[model samples]
Target: MSREKGKEFAEQDLTPMTGAATDVAPLGRQQKPAHELTADEDIDVADWDRVAAMAEFKQLVLAKRKFILPATIFFVVYYFALPALVGYAPGLMSKRVFGVVNVAYLFALSQFFMAWLIAALYVRAANRFDGMAQRIISKLKGGR
Candidate 1:
């Protein structure tokens, strides 16, 4: 597009991100309920109690807990280990593996990669979760 068109395009409103806490909507954005913005497929009409009580739903929740609990614990431990080691084991953290770069720097940098890896893993796991959820929806819709 031309520069002026691009500028005009950039001036257009974007959707307000869901879950943001603010009295006023942010500039160039409008707040809309999720149900209004996306195809529902009657997702909002599912009976909460029945859905929660289903064996598949129970399994799905369990799967999430199993994966999430450990990942959270590991991430927390790994994340805080940096500061803990720096404070408690300064000598170890200070040991230089490469010239001018020490263990502390390397470990800190690894946090970025670690976060990305966890995100990638979660995406894979989320696909399975989505499939489980869809199956439960189908069963609820009498497609079983």
Candidate 2:
């Protein structure tokens, strides 16, 4: 296409499709450059500032961070420690266990269980986070 045609196509008003629109976050929305958009653009977030400012929301963020930060740190340390021990402490890792299996093999196998355990813990924690979010939503909707 010609540059002028491309420009016209880019600037053309594309109306959202009829039907299948939701009360929140309607589909087929046209995206524009941030610089080209007006400051007062209607993005349809209802009282988002109030939501962000709500004590419940703040607590929810904090609760998430509390679980996530420690979990992330633990996982990173546990994961990196395997390679470090193998590379630095070969004698310790080479100690035979169960005839053929060794410490390194056992440790490597344990990682799978560790990952599963962490995932299970995260799922449990996520349920609490979801409840916290639901409470915040309820507050926004003028409920207890």
Candidate 3:
């Protein structure tokens, strides 16, 4: 509405500040016993058992790596390829359509397209990889 009303609303007190400026309270540093909290208890196990548990996790990691490597390569290639194309093709990207926005600039901006592309690929890959890992884990853990 009016500027003064807006200013007044903006200047309104939000929350109670704790103590003086020098007496700053630690934010979210509260300590509580494990049983007192709702969070799941951290299970303690031997290193060997941890390693054994990670066997399926290792396979999942490998599968993820497979996707990441290819996606990363594609992302890099796509990001740089437009600049290269513009470099080699002079005025190719300089063709202005709607105001100063040029084809080259738009092509460069298409890096977002590559990002989405890579993200989609990674998601699909991870899903498949996770499914495989789940199967393996279920078999190993006796249909868990």
Computed on alpha carbons, the lDDT of every model, listed in order, comes to 0.74, 0.74, 0.61
* Clash count of each predicted structure: 0, 0, 1
Expressed as tens digits, the lDDT of each residue in 1-144 for candidate 2 is 122332333343323343343323423666543333467874322345566778989999999999999999999999999999999999999999999899999999999999999999999999999999988766555522
What does candidate 3's lDDT look like per residue over 72-136, in tens digits? 88778878788688888867778997799988878777788768877887788778987986676
User: Could you tell me the lDDT of residue 53 within candidate 3?
Assistant: 64
Descending-TM-score candidate ranking? 2, 1, 3
Task: Show model 3 residue runs off by greater than 4 Å.
Answer: 1-62, 82-90, 97-101
**Candidate closest to the true structure, highest TM-score:** 2
Question: What TM-score would each prediction reach against the true structure?
Answer: 0.67, 0.70, 0.47
lDDT of 1 by residue, 1-144 (tens): 122332333343322345646444345555344444456432333345555767999999999999899999999999999999999999999999999899999999999999999999999999999999888766655523
CA lDDT, candidate 2, residue 73: 97
